[model samples]
Target: MLEIVAVPAFADNYLWLIHDPVSGETVAVDPGDSVPLLAEAERRGWPIGQVWNTHWHPDHSGGNEAVKQAGATVYAPASEAARIPGVDVALKEGDRVRIGEHQAEVWEVPGHTLGHIAYVLRDDGIAFVGDTLFAMGCGRLFEGTPQQMFESLQRIAALPADTRLYCAHEYTLSNARFAAAAEPANDAIAHRLKAVEQARQAGEMTVPTTVAEELQTNVFVRAHDPQDFARLRTSKDTFR
Candidate 1:
């Protein structure tokens, strides 16, 4: 089994460190800041051998150079290579990356960014989704259209029900609030909202959410069509 640790950075971002005991190989995913990420890896005695980025956003790829300098090979989206620093390997859709004995298939899940991608470890039933999909929400579509985002989210939703989606932010509380409003009649949303509220109050992480959970409570995923998704995405922009 892989040991995944969440290293929090920049108030809400989570930089993931994945360690495979069998191969003794470690990988850093979307490391925005190398300081904490490196420290945590050292503490665990897991030297980072690879850095995998999902996009070119500063907050997601800021530490690319630093991690690369520390002897880690950097892997970033081929389409956004110009924006990402120190990329040793440029990955595209259908590409495969390996850490120890585990393999991840690169999926083009553009939405949050025009070049955003996801790393899906199908055998492990895990996906590192970057900013494309959130706990009960979706990315803001900064460089992609609502139609693109809708399709990306639907693709993620089509994964196995038990697949664990590892999104990059800690936005579950606010998303849950909006989900409750988006589906006032949904008992699942109400129930999940209450749970998320309590989790946040207790300072607990509410991510690595399952596909099944999102299907039951995420309004964006439940949207009837691209038009409905667009409206929901527009509404969420200024939901407060």
Candidate 2:
């Protein structure tokens, strides 16, 4: 079976460790820091051999060099390889990354960064989204336009409802608040907000949010058009 464990880094980033017990191989995704990630790997006895990057953000690929130093190969986006410190493989859309017997489809999800990408383990119904789509929010428009972000979100929304979304940050509580603000009348958002608050109070992880939950509550994904999406993105940016 494919087991994904979340390794908290910095203040809020979630560095994922994908392990395949059958082959005893491990894959690290968007490791923002080396200290915690390497430590967790050692504690769990999962020797990481591959590192998959989603973008060139410092908070995402900052640990690439260190992970490489630990004998792991790095796989990054083809378009943004120059920005990443150490990229062993430059991948594009339709490419596949394998961990043991499991394979994940690579997609170019540009918006947070011009070369931002995401990985979907189709058979396992899991997706590792970088900074593109958050729990209830979306990534900021750093290099790409709102149109690109909107389209990218649509692509993700096309996934099966059962797909578990593993985004890079632990922003569910804040996002739930924003979701409720965006759609005041949404009972789903209200319900999620209450649940997220409780989870945060108890010091729990609010990730692995299913696609069904996002569809029912994510205002950004429910946006009807680019104009609508753009307006909402602007609102979220200035909100707070």
For each candidate in turn, the TM-score is: 0.99, 0.99
**lDDT, residue 85, model 2:** 83
After superposing candidate 2 on the true structure, give the runs of residues whose Cα lies further than 4 Å from its correct spot. Answer: none
lDDT digits (tens) for residues 1-240 of candidate 2: 798999999999999999999999999999889899999999999999999999999889999999999989999999999999899999999999999889999999999999999999999999999999989878999999889999999999899999999999998888888889999999999999999999999999999888898899999998999899999999888888
Off by over 4 Å in 1: none
- Score candidate 1 by TM-score against the native: 0.99
Residue 200 of model 1 has an lDDT of: 90
Q: Write the per-residue lDDT of candidate 1 for residues 60-149, one digit (tens) a residue.
A: 999988888888999999999999999989999999999888999999998789999999999999999999999999999899988889
- The superposed Cα distance between candidate 2 and the true structure at residue 213, in angstroms, equals 0.4
**Best candidate, lDDT-wise?**
1
Worst 10 residues of 2 by lDDT: 170-179
Provide the lowest-lDDT 10-residue window in model 1: 141-150
